[model samples]
Target: MPRTVPRLVSAIAALATVAVLAGCSTAPSRPLEGYAGEPKGVDAPASSAGGASWTAWLEDGTQFAIVLYGSSTCPPKVQNVAATADDTITATLAPAPGGICTHDIVPHTTVFSTPERITKTAEVKVVMPDTTLTLPTRQG
Candidate 1:
């Protein structure tokens, strides 16, 4: 009985340790300000029938802003900061994490034109990874 008591106590202790460890584990947290860098130059891409899309890769920051201008009929472009890739116009974007980011703007479905073309220009700002590369509007 004495030996059985010690084994039972040991088992209980092991279970408790496992539970505590499990509880300590959590999903990795994404930092908002962890990315800190500069904005890089901008470039342009070939025009597409659907429309144009702009992308700016951050050089050393976690957030970035992109200004997109469309035709007079389209909505006015504005600047926005991104926390996650989903925060941008496209959810699939993978902005470089940790002090580097990318900004991409795609035309919404509301765009209407026989051969839709963005009449205006796009401005991009990147932050993080310590390098900035701007490509001009490319077809979406």
Candidate 2:
């Protein structure tokens, strides 16, 4: 009986380890669109309004990041973007996948490649849920 007990415990341990690994990879994360680095030139105006939504330039002026603060583990990200006008963009979020999320406020940045039709010379407006973030005019 003692020998069988040890073997059963070992088997349970192995199963638990496999379950953890599978759980980590099962849920989808926000796919990376481009480099998330901060741009050196003219960029978006930063604000903590509502302490949640914000925007920043990335990869010079070719890309930008829409940031939302919430659970660090399951942070919400911009799933889709389309230019509604020359200086305006419409943003949407993906359906929140079910998973354990850390109870902490951290920035989840979703990078996006700037569309060709979007004007870079004027104030760019990103229309998001409950807010509209504005980016300053791009400078040389």
Candidate 3:
């Protein structure tokens, strides 16, 4: 009985130590939030080339960035700063893929402003190609 007491105590202590280590090593997870932006509207023109636009408004205390996914050919660009307020900045569309081309805008990073104020409206433009062609074209 005396030997059994020491063994039981050691077993409990080992389990407690394992529990403490497991709790210490576990990581905490947080929910992902969307970017701070208000959509003004989207614009697309005909003729398979030329004018296209995308606009958005940013809110206060939010940081954001612009990302463009495009083919190896023509790429998108962030145009002018359309509007700027005390706590906001607006950007206009530049040019990007059009004529059956697609692109994705991803927010890669964010920068915080002082006093937690809004900053930047976003804009993007689509530019069409003269003609469509497949990639990795084989030469005859």
Candidate 4:
């Protein structure tokens, strides 16, 4: 029976440790999860693409990229994306992480997994806060 005290104390200690660790959380990661990267030609001004923003399907319809143009150092990012219809997508930008950013406009790409509801083979309209881009169906 005396041994039960030590077991009980050990259980409580383990639980406390777990609770403390669970409460401790690291700062949010800078890069969006799933995928984020600066695609090639990022050096070119976004206008070179004849637009300030665009979207594309990547890796055989598994993921999509949202490209936004602004300060290279503090460009807007895609916080989340959803398919409201088989041929439509909505992209929500992450609130700008306020900070000093380069005045120059450059392209930054943020990729998100294609929502299951999206029909990648169809012309998908990406609706954003700024504009709607009609992305032609991806060619095999």
Candidate 5:
């Protein structure tokens, strides 16, 4: 009987310790406003052609940075930008010379300002050579 009492008390103490530690664990933080996902769909054909490969957030809510990375013999330029009714902004880019591009990866970055501020759940669409990526903005 004496041995059983000590064992039971030790078991209760261990459980209490675990409960306290679990309660002290931190919760996950919310994402910052205007935060977007990393660049995607930058593979194969797009990598062979110059295009807007990825996008990132800027300090200002209405501005974003677009990265053009690929292997176009000539530099690429932004041709058109359109905003759809579904809160998605699309930007199209093509090579300047319109010929066979090199196989080397060239990178360029440019900043674009939107007519209005992008809210938490807005989407950004990047139209590349053979693909389009739609990314959602961070919610916080």
Candidate 6:
């Protein structure tokens, strides 16, 4: 009976360890916000009025913008922003620094101007860790 008890305890410990490791392996959840659809081709220039910063325009004329809310523990770094030949606006956002951020939602603006005018059929795509947001262009 003594040997059986020890074996049972060992099995339980192994199961507990597996459960803890499985929980730790789960990926962190990042909730996304802002519009994720067709962009209304409004001629209004980018402004910080709504806490959204204009990122840029794609070769096909799609507008890109970043909508910021909540306190970021680290500033969101822009790694790359470019217009591809296929008329898609591609952007990569770097991970923020490690720090404590407030719970308040703060809106910030970023504007980008391109020599090329907006195209009626352009699309915007923002890529991040485990997340992708695609915004299509809509006729005004």
Lowest summed lDDT across 10 adjacent residues in model 3 is found at 131-140
Q: On residues 28-122, what C-alpha lDDT tens digit does candidate 3 reach at each position?
A: 11212223222223222232133222222223323223332233344454443311223333433355556664344322211222112222222
* Candidate with better lDDT, 3 vs 5: 5
After the best TM-score superposition of candidate 4, give how far the Cα of residue 80 lies from its true spot, in angstroms. 0.4
Q: lDDT tens string, model 5, 1-140?
A: 99999999999999999987664423321222211222233323344254346655555445555565655455454554545433555565643676777876665555556534235366666455556755457545
User: Which number leads on lDDT?
Assistant: 2
Q: Between which residue pairs do clashes occur in model 5?
A: 73-101
TM-score of 6: 0.39
lDDT of 4 by residue, 21-139 (tens): 65443222232342334554324335536536776666677776677777767877877766666687777778898777788776678867777666668798988887897766878
lDDT of 2 by residue, 60-98 (tens): 678877777777667676788877667887887877879
Report residue 105 deviation for candidate 3 (angstroms).
11
Clashing pairs in 6: 53-110, 54-110, 61-119, 70-105
lDDT of 5: 0.52
Residue 93 lDDT in model 2?
Answer: 84
Query: Model 3, clash count?
Result: 6
lDDT of 2 at 94: 76
Assess every candidate by TM-score: 0.23, 0.65, 0.24, 0.64, 0.47, 0.39
Where does model 2 exceed 4 Å of error? 1-46
| Error at 38, model 1, angstroms | 16
RMSD of each: 16.8, 15.9, 18.5, 10.9, 15.9, 13.7
Local distance difference test, each candidate: 0.32, 0.70, 0.32, 0.68, 0.52, 0.45
For model 2, what is the error of residue 57's alpha carbon versus the real structure, in angstroms, after optimal superposition? Answer: 1.9
- How big is the positional error of residue 37 in model 6, measured in Å on the Cα after superposition? 20
| Cα lDDT of model 6 by residue, 35-94, tens digit | 432123433335435444344333344234444443544434444444442334345554
